[model samples]
Target: MNSVNSSQNNLLFTSRCPEVRDAQWVCQKVKNTFPHISTTKISAKMADIEEANWDLYRKFIDKPEYALLYNKNPKDRKFLRLFAWRRRIVKRIHDARESWRIGGKDDYHRVNNVLGQFKYDKLGNCGEDAFMAATILRINGVDNTCTAGLKVDGSFLDHMVCVFNKDGSTFNGKPNKNTIIIDPWVGMADFASNMFQKYKNVFSELLIGIKPQSEITFRNVDEVGISGMERFLLIMKHPELCYPNSAREFMRKK
Candidate 1:
């Protein structure tokens, strides 16, 4: 049944959904084209353009969750520190493991839907976890993307990771000038160092980054050995996974 709308609950409904969707494209454009752009500049621009349309989006940006998640509250700065390594960040991951359930096999869900279940103290697989982390970072004015890769061949995603940019010359215990790979589930930041943590040699290949401006495309994702009924059930349960195949041929090319 359709529920009555009030100013308190109508913010999301009255706001144009396409505006937020297009806002993603705008953010992606900034990230891919000018990765070195200042976070303050990006945040300001997004606030002017996107925030005008979605009040809830703006509220999420101004929230103190980033500080709480990192266990550091900077009075002067609005956004969290980039690539700032804090002990509480790791502790948060470990604590989350205790509350979030290890979801069933092949149970993929979108970031928004997976986040909704969080109120019930439920969790999803690696992909869901990575996407949720990426969303939080994005809301906190951090540029991030959800990445996926295959295990071997004709198999589901072997692992998922969130990629972001750090302004300084080093991050996550690496000499990266920009890119930093973060695995929210395992609390691993450096992929080169944590190769064996999630899966042995998972990053020995390439994985497409799902960012706002990304144009990566896929075909025949359902070519796996799973039966049609099983695949249909999985898709019905998690419609986001049915949108486009995450696997890319670049891994095989490498």
Candidate 2:
């Protein structure tokens, strides 16, 4: 892993950072376009965020210590099945994100701080949140896909999330008939409808099933002043920053 990191860093920095550029553009646009957004609107956004955080905390983090005992016995098929079926782990991941944000972490989220050990002071953004959920799902022997994609008409593929099947089992290593998507980044809002509102016509099962490093190009990307190659190179660097729980555990074992 260290060797791989060395090689990736050695890749030339000839391209602009799409994430950084797009983020700055967004910030500037918001500042310029809505110099004085209504306090009511801001309060509503905060309310939604708070509601999601509250649900996650009550559902997962606020539970009694004995609740963990269910996970202690591997042979308890009923409990394990129940555990795997419900969205508790996903909620925990969401709780971590809320805690991280509330603690005032920076935008460039560091994944290790949240997943390996819960650090309220060091939080992660959407991608790290999704990766954390994916790690937990994988640990529980659940089938899921962690994805990265643009907001469909947008220039940057800046979000990441975990997509899963309604039934835990996969058909021939592919997602089964009914697929459910979970975005810890978006918190606990009705994810399906929220996703449709954000991604609209472009998000489909095809995006969920997309293989790693799949090529996708957005029209009018140059309008953002970043080329497609720059976006590609930027995304290539992101996965290296993610410190999934499995990787952290392996490091501790070493």
Candidate 3:
């Protein structure tokens, strides 16, 4: 990892780092467009951000297919069989999307990762939420703001979050005791320890059938090799690589 750090730094500087560039664009846009947000107290700003319902994007996109199946006769055995088959097909398509590898076929169902686009689309999953939150914090003068990824049970890279200095101090990669974590996906922001306790319950619910053993690890986007939009899409598609792991785990449990 140490040997790659230099190249990583170079990548972060050159055209290879569109994610970083996009984040900067978001910060600048927020600063220019929403200057009032930065003038408010930090707590107030965070609370205002918490009110946003961006997770609706996921809910909207994930609605099951074959809604007409629900209108079929409940008493008919054939209808039941066909409905069950439709459900299986829906689950299979979802699983295929989740398990898609980086170099596999192009993913047309990519989540909105371009942070600047969030202003207009108001649609995104955890990655977009984290990206926007971290950039907003920076625009609001939290110089230590960092977009972090979470690995559950030591393997599944299934969540994204924003970490920043609680006392408004600048720092490098990762968070310390002085840092606070803001998870826009769950609409909560608190000190690191408190946030994790709150998030554990939510995580358990989100990843049904896979009980997390309290093993949560965080990594900055730079450390994960997600340097561009294409890489971000690949990461987002796989539960073991990015957000919302429930479907994959549920299928595995069955």
Best by TM-score: 3
lDDT of 1 by residue, 32-64 (tens): 321221222233344454445354334434764
* TM-score of each model, in listed order: 0.29, 0.30, 0.43
What CA RMSD would you report for each candidate? 20.3, 20.0, 18.3
- The list of candidate 2 runs beyond 4 A from truth reads 1-120, 168-177, 189-194, 198-254
Candidates sorted on lDDT, descending: 3, 2, 1
Ranking by TM-score: 3, 2, 1
Candidate 3 Cα RMSD (Å): 18.3
lDDT of 3 by residue, 67-185 (tens): 33343545443433544444455454344434432343322222222332333432245664565566444333344566777765667666777766555565454456665666655
Off by over 4 Å in 3: 1-71, 74-116, 167-175, 207-212, 222-254
Consecutive 10-residue window with the lowest summed lDDT within model 3: 34-43
Question: What C-alpha lDDT values do all the predictions have?
Answer: 0.36, 0.37, 0.45
Which candidate should be chosen as best, given lDDT against the real structure?
3
Lowest lDDT 10-mer window, candidate 1? 216-225
Indicate whether candidate 2 or candidate 3 has the larger lDDT: 3
What's the lDDT for residue 188 in model 3?
59
